[model samples]
Target chain A: MTKPTGPSRRTFLKTTAAATLAAPTIVSPSIFAKGDTPAPSDRVVVGSIGVGDLGRRHHLNNKLLVNPRIQVAAVCDVDRNHRDLAANDVLTKSGKMPGVYKDFRDLCDRKDIDAVFVVTPDHWHALVSIYAMETGKDVYCEKPLTLNIEEGKKMVEVARRYGAVFQTGSQQRSEGPFRQAVELIRNGKIGKVQRVDTYIGNIDAGKWQAPITPPPELDWNFWLGPAPYADYFPNRCHYQFRWFSDYSGGKMTDWGAHHNDITQWALEKDQSGPVKVRCEQAQFAPDGPHDVALEFDIAYTYADGVELHCHSQGKNGIKFTGTDGWVFVSRSQKEFDAHDKALLTWQAGDNDVNLPRTETKHPHHDNFLDCIASRQRPICDVEIGHRSATVCHLGNIAIRLGRELQWDPAKEEFVGDDQANQLVGKPMRAPWHL
Target chain B: MATVTELAGDLCSGDQVKTYQAQQALARLSGEIGASGKEAEKAEAAKALAAVLAGVKPAKDNRGEATVDSIKSVNSANELCRALSLLAGEAEVAVLAECLKNIDLRETARWCLARMTCQGAADALVEAYKTATGTEYRVGLINALGRKQGSNVLETLKLAAADKEPEVALAAVEALANTPDAALDAVISSVESGSSSRRAARVARARVRLGSTLLRAGDDAGAKKVFTAVAGADVDEAPKKAAAAAVGG
Candidate 1:
């Protein structure tokens, strides 16, 4: 299953190019060429909600998207500043002013938009995603995929019912190094890998010490969304929301989402999670300030006999150790191996990745865009998202319980222990439904 | 989610078995009363059967490699490694050697070694030695040996680094790069090895030893690519051209 490297970032680029040539009647490369974007017979329209930290960075930049014919028909976010900025950004790029809304549900009601990007926090991801799918919009969500394992389950169910293409923002799955690392593992480059040492670190408690103040114009309650209202801390809000447990699972889900996702994808365990989560931990200085595990050593054991040890190093990256040799990959320029400068030549997954009739490198957003047009599923699709996030949630559960927990992925609960089983899903704030 | 009856070696057989039996009795009693109870009784019966019959012990002192299955398979392998990883004192070292029998699982072997700290990844070296066999592997073994701490690897590595075969010696010297300043000069000679791959790796290791990574941290080489890769290639709009300024510094 593992092909030799030495190709380009699009390693299977030529094959996909040839595929585009052969599949011309359906959406193909000729249609996706920058100026020649064949319109979807019907234009694929989109709306966006909650343009904060994740939204601005992950959803607004579709101008470079290979599918040039798509429209950003509407944008919504509770924060006026974000809404104004996002609206203008879309206008400048697409040459059309999109309708703006403060209420996300109002934005979702628009029949014009066939899809929407839910770039809100962890808590809002489920609600926005489910409602959009129900309203006939495919969804693209930022990663740490869901607030918890329970929300993810419901979101997957809703997407299936509505037949929406839901993409989780695990874009690293598309990156060359990450893909190479996975391919190498899957092919036994590391040789019958047993334990993978994943270093996804912490929010380091003091990082959330900013003054507690919320801006007047922002709807702080709505921003909190499904999460319980906490004393507002500037560091605990916006992009830094990940450090707070009400919205995020600290680094367990923040960086864990990215790192665990690669493990999940490669191990072929994304649709399920480890049956056991054991957190061997240490408390941080004033650990009570943040909600999730402060500094911990945790081991996650999957049903397929692979054990993932997500260790807290306060840094990011994953090191996979197998029976053969091992490879350490990270985003940092400063590293120990520091000299394995092999370039990545991209390859298309003809059999596995199963690209649709369209030809595009932009699989993440393009999935959302294509789903809007063809009414199909995306690559880092929603169920994949929910399963990956469940891995993250298991880490949180182990940390919260302060002990080892045996999870039944088949039933999605802690085995025979009602106290722990109760923790799988969280209590949503009143008046919000997914 | 296969159940093991408290594998920590802490479960006393008589008490543990009796407690398990008592729970079984309770479930059976509950099942006698209702049909709903019957399903649970069946489940408990199945689980009990799985638990009592689950484990397989390795053939003692043979240390020849064996594949275990899980009605004892991968679960057996996982339990063996995990249980073996948790042991302490004199038994830990021998059990780790047993773990090395599965010579193919190097990464887990390295991690288990790192956790064991039995002279800084000695299990990996031992596995490399045990698996490699003959004179060709002596250099690779010596290289792996240098990955460990202590005086034992030093003399052996030094001797191998001066081997009759230049390529073997080159591998030995490369192993010393992982060692400190004591072996710096020995590793440097390999920068121009008879083998290209070995020479390139030596050069790279030497650069790493000199602390010369290709780019500075936050130098943000290929700024747009780096930024897009770090930021959002899928979603984010604002191009931080500021990222370019952060590069090449």
Candidate 2:
């Protein structure tokens, strides 16, 4: 199929000019146009995919139910019990029963559903999001954006091709302190930035889960959709799936999705990444159950001479050091810190750049809805998500290969190293073509 | 903060001196080779590349052959394809597939498409092969598609195997040799009918290879069946011996 052309350059230029001059928070009135009358028709109909922990608790019960402007039209999960629970919760809260589906495609096919909240496993992220977009539904996909680097690339391309407004679940982008830290860095409060230190946590290794029959409530095949088929075990399916490379990228991508994202935003390098990546002091379990790194320090160097140091031993946050000063912030941190405490009080002038603002339980989710109405790009768009995820994936590659690799960010490739480039995009099992 | 559009204009300027400078400016805007550019900058470069591909004409070489020699001479052809790959989709794939007809740029274009994350790229190659008039060019496109993995290209390979041109059909058969069960089934059926095996020796070898895939998948029964068939086939001695060894017949 031939790709569709985007809006003309002239149109893009005009829209950009308007966006640049507008306030940091740009919300289209159509999102709440019917809300003035408070009618059901006016409410944005949203479907919640994967009614698991975050899907049920944070997304459906907390945010979607609480948001008056949104109506939870559908809840889908491969696990029958999870979907039923979510549907029941929605009914109890909204006094209306939501349509339940065992398959995500059924949810996407609904004409009433305007958008989908994909809180599925990392491996399913790109497929579900792409399929939803292909069905003409906007998506708020959870991070890390994809299971592998190739999947992320495909997600970005397909999202744009279908004109879908995609928001990655990198909520750090929406947090107040994170934005403030980025703004401070952007305004050069930290002088010419040189290095950034990000600490998320250690990787999980040397743990094995014996194969067990999948629970009756779950459709193991559907759950393992694009991921390689494997014998089911309790630990390999749910929250613990993060420990497996086939399902997730361990803590490197898990927490790195948030911290590396902020690092990219602060460096204003969301479209690109570091040129060279190296790992030191890494160890791994010989056999499976969980096969991620034990511990390591990863170093990434940008062509323009900026450095990013990621390790597990440091404070659990990002510390940006520049010529003059430094600043640090983390989700777990009670308060943000700067070299000079007064720097935290620095406000932007009329001419200073202000990143977009989001203040909701899931700011990125709210941003997705707003962008769906405005036909604008969300704060953490698919491309930005892909780039951020690429950083984490690179760290994993460096560790796994036990070597330093030169990366060409512009080409999104490892420079002249066929072996390294091979890891950039892995082959999927049969019947699953991305 | 030079706009990618401005830099792209410089790149397409035909003047050797100005074009190199323009390429440098575009490279810098993309944040050197090793660095990452801003989102806006990346977007602009993508747009600029699209526009250049659409409008920029090929330059004349010293031998007066109409070629993109100006860009190729400076190693910018690969660079252009890389930039295009960054923002590539079906549209970019179509353009690159068309470039496969250009012998000078075919390798670079294939390399560009091979590295892309877009799945439509494989489909584009198949589409290009069907439409490609020249037997040689069609074979080249088939060879390129051969290196691609996935079942997406399976049907295309099967179709190409039926080509009236023996060369094209042979190339398609050669490509199908490494495919899994599905493609193997098609190859086996074609060989049984004595149509796909114009080069009979390769078909015997492919059968042996398919049988090997089954053996590795732990389907000894199916593997033995395939090997027995190849061993029984009225073909070359080499393939018969190979199949006999596989089945220990």
Q: Model 1, B76-173: lDDT tens per residue?
A: 33323332332222334444444445433332333334333345356445544545434533553554464466665665666666666565565566
Worst 10 residues of 2 chain A by lDDT: A1-10
Worst 10 residues of 1 chain A by lDDT: A336-345
* Chain B TM, every candidate: 0.41, 0.65
Q: Note the DockQ of each predicted structure.
A: 0.01, 0.02
- lDDT (C-alpha) at residue A325 in model 1: 68
CA lDDT, candidate 2, residue A315:
75
For residues A339-430, what per-residue lDDT tens digits would candidate 2 score against the true structure?
A: 97888788777689777875555566667766765567888999999999999999988876666889998888898655467668754432
Deviating ranges (above 4 Å) for candidate 2: A1-38, A203-207, A286-288, A360-362, B1-249
- CA-RMSD of model 1: 26.3
True contacts kept of each: 0.00, 0.00
Candidate 2: TM-score of chain A is 0.91
